[model samples]
Target: MPAITPEQRVLDNLRDTLQAYVAGDVAATAVVTVFRGQAPALALPEAFQRVLDELLRRLEMADVFSQDSCSFSSTGIQEQLGVWLDKAEARVSARTA
Candidate 1:
């Protein structure tokens, strides 16, 4: 089996962090920190970064409201994060391949 790349590791961590945040085991800031801290390691495209930033922004707003206010559903954001993960993994794999 091919060894996991650093980008893959970062992506996995982000997914796990998002899950933990939804579970209330982690703070919203911590989740944002994980994304910001590890983003460089992923070497993501600018498009991905922009999308992530938008998601993080929505996440912060969601946290502030602490409910499905302003149409910012934490659950919806989490689902978006999952989709982001899928696309990021594909992008990373394509690059490596």
Candidate 2:
């Protein structure tokens, strides 16, 4: 079995958390909250962080703010997630090279 790198672990966690959020899992908020709590230490560039912050805010708004009032659509969330993942993968590739 191959050992997972910290970067891969983080990415995997993010992917799983995003999937949970999209699926309306009850624990999504807590997971995202914890992830955001550790975001500062991730050493992400300001631009990347800004985009990610927006994505997080959208996810929170969809999941928490409208939980009782309206149904949350995962379309926008998935798009933002794709963007973030692409960028993160690029950064990982650069770092590994």
Which candidate gets the maximum lDDT versus the true structure?
1
Most TM-score-accurate candidate: 1
Candidate 2 clash pair list:
none
Candidate 1 weakest ten by summed lDDT = 66-75
**Per-candidate local distance difference test:** 0.87, 0.68
Model 1: lDDT of residue 30: 94
Query: Please, what are the lDDT tens digits per residue for candidate 2 over residues 1-97?
Result: 7676777777777777767766767364665685586555456789878887877666677666654343444466666776787778678758866
Query: What TM-score goes with each of the models?
Result: 0.90, 0.71
Specify the poorest-scoring 10-residue window by lDDT in model 2.
65-74
State residue 3's C-alpha deviation in candidate 1, in Å.
Answer: 1.4
Task: Give the alpha carbon lDDT tens digit for every residue of 3-97 in model 1.
Answer: 98888888889889988988989998898899888876888889999999999899889889975776799889888988988898898899999
Tell me model 1's lDDT, rounded to 2 decimals: 0.87
